[model samples]
Target: MSKVRWKPGNLIYPLPAALVSCRSKTHGDNLITIAWTGTICTNPPMCYISIRPDRYSYDIINESKEFVINLTTTQMARGTDWCGVKSGRDYDKFKECGFTKGEAEVVDVPLVNESPLAIECKVVEIKELGSHHMFIANVVSATVDDKYLDDTGAFNLNQSDLICYSHREYRKLGQKIGHFGYAVKKLKKKPRRKKIN
Candidate 1:
């Protein structure tokens, strides 16, 4: 089969559509639905979200240096889309979208109580990349819904109906095909039965 060539672009789709909440010490809170966000580091537990400087939430984040990344789910698709299209400058997103504004564990930003998981982050660095500025933040604390926890008290995020963004549409995550390193890692097994003959 032949394929048509296209210009180079950031066409990477199927990304998590997170609702990033931020608040200033003076102003009220706001939520910005961000699709340009992802995990950036491990040791420091960092992540990054790219935002246009003109966006209303940009100033709040720039001044506060902290925000809460609320993981959205299929149930929150309507609110997620609303948060992205509407301007926080005029609308109270939390109230208008019917989402609860809960207190954050580590940052001044408010977290969405309805979200299954919320990660509080503090900005560590900022890089101006043309049209958008990437804010690299370190995860200060993570709060997960108790209902999603397993019997062992471990958080099971996979069980949540997580939503992702692809080509301007929201998509729910699907089944897991494999675990980390399952493709090439040697599997542990019961010691080979020793022949006693």
Candidate 2:
């Protein structure tokens, strides 16, 4: 196969379409659907979300310095798209999207009740980039929906219909590709049965 070169751009596809919730003294509570979000570090538990400077939630986040990243599912596709398009400056996204504001354990910001998981973050620093400003944050708290927690206390995120964003469309997370370290890890060998035969 041959490869074609295109113009320079950030072409990383399949990003989590997280619902970022925040609150400010003046703005109250709001939601902003963000695809430009991901985990940055794991040791101290860090993550980030990038937003345009002109976005309505940008100032609110600046004032609050905290936000909740609510993981979205295929069931939440409609609300996710709507929140991304509408502005907090004009509409109350939570109310419009019919999303319940769940209380976060650590952060002042509220989380999406319908989300299977919520990552509460506190702003550590803000890097002003060209079109978008990145909010580098330390993960303060993470709450998973009780429904996703099994009897054994294992979180079955695979059972939840999680989704991702690619290009301009939201897509469901299909079949399990592989587990972490599956490449180098040893595979179990099947037991031999000969005496019984």
Candidate 3:
């Protein structure tokens, strides 16, 4: 096999494709498609989203200190891509993309009701890094569609059909290969054989 080295750039693929909703008093509501977002901490439930300062949502989120992260699905690929390219200053992305906005539990920012999963976040801190600023937010509340719940009251996120963004393309997630500790965790031990004679 042959390999070639490439320049240092964004090589990480398969990031969650999310429509981040933020609002301002003047602009009312807006949505920005984001791929640079992920969970930073689990204990206090923290996450971070990186965005350029010039983006429309940047100012809104900075001023309001809150936003909703709406998980995207395969069905929303087109809308997600469109929102990323189009600026909120020119158009009402939520209305144009046929997405419904519902009141967020923690913040005034509206959540995308069309999304199967919506996470309401409150900005805890901000870090300015070169081109993009990172908004470190503590997840305030989350709302998921009841239909995604299993009979045992377990949330089945996979059934919601999540989507991912790689480079500049949108892709749907595939089947689950294994659980958290499937590789190392021991399975049920077989019953020991009874003593012979």
Candidate 4:
């Protein structure tokens, strides 16, 4: 195999397409579809979302310092793309997208009711990283839909029909290949059958 050289850029494929909701004193409620989002830390439960300064929700989140990261699904693919393209400056995203505003436990910002999971976050720091500014936030609370909970009380996120963004297209998640550490996990051995003598 041979490799081709190209311009330096972010070419990481297949990122979770998240719908981030926020509000401010002047802006009211708004939703912004973000592909550039991820978990940053585990202990304190932190995450980040990078947004361009010109985006309508950028000011809303920057001033409010709070938002909810709602995981998207295949059902929400069209709306997610719409929210990203349309600006809250003219359109009421929640109303336009028909997204229900679910009340967050700790933060005043609202989560998307249709979402299987919602993570409430408070901005801890902001870094001006060129074209997009990164908002580092601490996850204050999270709400999971009871429908996705298995009988064993484990969250079955795989069953939610979630979608992700790759290149320039949105695609539904495929089959579960394996879990973490499965490469080194020992498989259980079956018991030997008793001798029939």
Candidate 5:
């Protein structure tokens, strides 16, 4: 096999396409679709979202120091793409997207009711990195839709038909081959019965 080299850039594909909602005393409520977001830590439950300074929600989040990260689904593909392309400065995203504003428990910001899961975050720090500024936040609370829970009360997120962003396209999740620890898990062999003469 041969390898081709290219200039250094953000080549990572298949990232979670999140809808980040924010509200300010002056700007009201707004939603911004973000692909550059991910969990940063486990213990304290930290996450980060990078947004351009010119984005409408950037100033709202910066001033409020809070936002809700709503996980997107295949059903929300159009709205997700639309929100990213259009600015909240001119449009009321929640109303235009037909999404109800659900009240968050820990923060004053509203979440997208259509979302299966909403992660409420409070900004802890900000880092200016060229084109986009990063908002490092701590997860204050997370709300999951009860409809996705099984009889055993386990959250089946895969059943939600979640969508992801890859390259310049939005794609749905594929088949699940295995779960965590399945690679090293032992398989049990059935006992053979002795033949009777």
Candidate 6:
């Protein structure tokens, strides 16, 4: 098959649309919907979120050095898009979006109570990358909504109807075909019973 080529740019799609909440003494709490966010490490538990320096939430996060990453769901699609479009300078996102501010355990910032998962992060470093500044942080704490927990106490995140950002569009997570290692795992064969003549 032939393919057409385009100029180099960020082609990665279907990224997690997280609402990052930040607060400081000078500035009140604010939520910024971030699509440029992901886990950087697993051992020490680290993540990063890239935001435009001009964003109101950027200063609050820089001053506080902490933020909570709240996972978005299909129910929060409107609020997520709204928060990203509107500036915190004019609107109180939490109140406007009808979201409750739930206190985080390790960070001073509050999390979105409606979210199924909230990850509290403390900034360790900041990289000014042209258009956006990447905040590299260590995960201080992570809280999950009990409603998303299965009977075995395992997190059923897929059932949460999580939403993602793809090419400026918000989409819900689709069907799950397999687990982490299913592709490489061997299938067990059933033992055949001897026929009695």
TM-score: the better of candidates 2 and 4: 4
Candidate 4 segments exceeding 4 Å error: none
Considering TM-score, where higher is better, how would the candidates rank from best to worst?
6, 4, 5, 2, 3, 1
Q: How high is the CA lDDT of each candidate model?
A: 0.93, 0.94, 0.91, 0.95, 0.95, 0.95
After superposing candidate 5, which stretches have Cα over 4 Å from the reference? 194-197
TM-score of each: 0.92, 0.95, 0.94, 0.98, 0.97, 0.98
Model 4: pairs clashing at backbone N, Cα or C within 3 Å: none
- Candidate 2 lands at a TM-score of 0.95
lDDT, candidate 4, 48-143, per-residue tens: 999999999999999999999999999888999999999999999899989999999999899999999999999999999999999999999999
Candidate 6 off by > 4 Å: none
Q: Mind giving the per-residue lDDT tens digits that candidate 3 earns over 2-114?
A: 99999998889989999999988866799999999999999999999999999999999998898999998888889988999999989999889998889888888888887
Residue-level lDDT for 52 in candidate 4 = 98
Candidate 6: lDDT of 55? 94
lDDT string for model 5 (1-197, tens) is 99999999898999999999999999999999999999999999999999999888999999999999999999998999999999999999988888898989999999898899999999999999999999999999999999999999999989999999999899999999999999999999889999999
lDDT of 5 at 17: 92
Show the lowest summed lDDT stretch of 10 residues, model 6: 148-157
RMSD of each: 2.3, 1.5, 2.0, 0.8, 1.0, 0.8
Q: How many steric overlaps are in each model, in order?
A: 0, 0, 0, 0, 0, 0
Q: Mind giving the per-residue lDDT tens digits that candidate 6 earns over 1-197?
A: 99999999998998999999999988898999999999999989999999999999999999999999999999999999999999999999999999999988999999899999999999999999999999999999999999988889999888999999999899999999899999999999899999999
**On TM-score, who's better, 1 or 2?**
2
> Model 2: runs farther than 4 Å from truth?
194-197
On a 0 to 1 TM-score scale, where does candidate 5 land against the true structure?
0.97
Q: Put down candidate 2 lDDT per residue, 1-197, tens digits, no spaces.
A: 99999999988999999999999999999999999999999989999999998999999999999999999998889999999999998998988999999999999999899999999999999999999999999999999988988899999987889999998889999998999999999879999978974
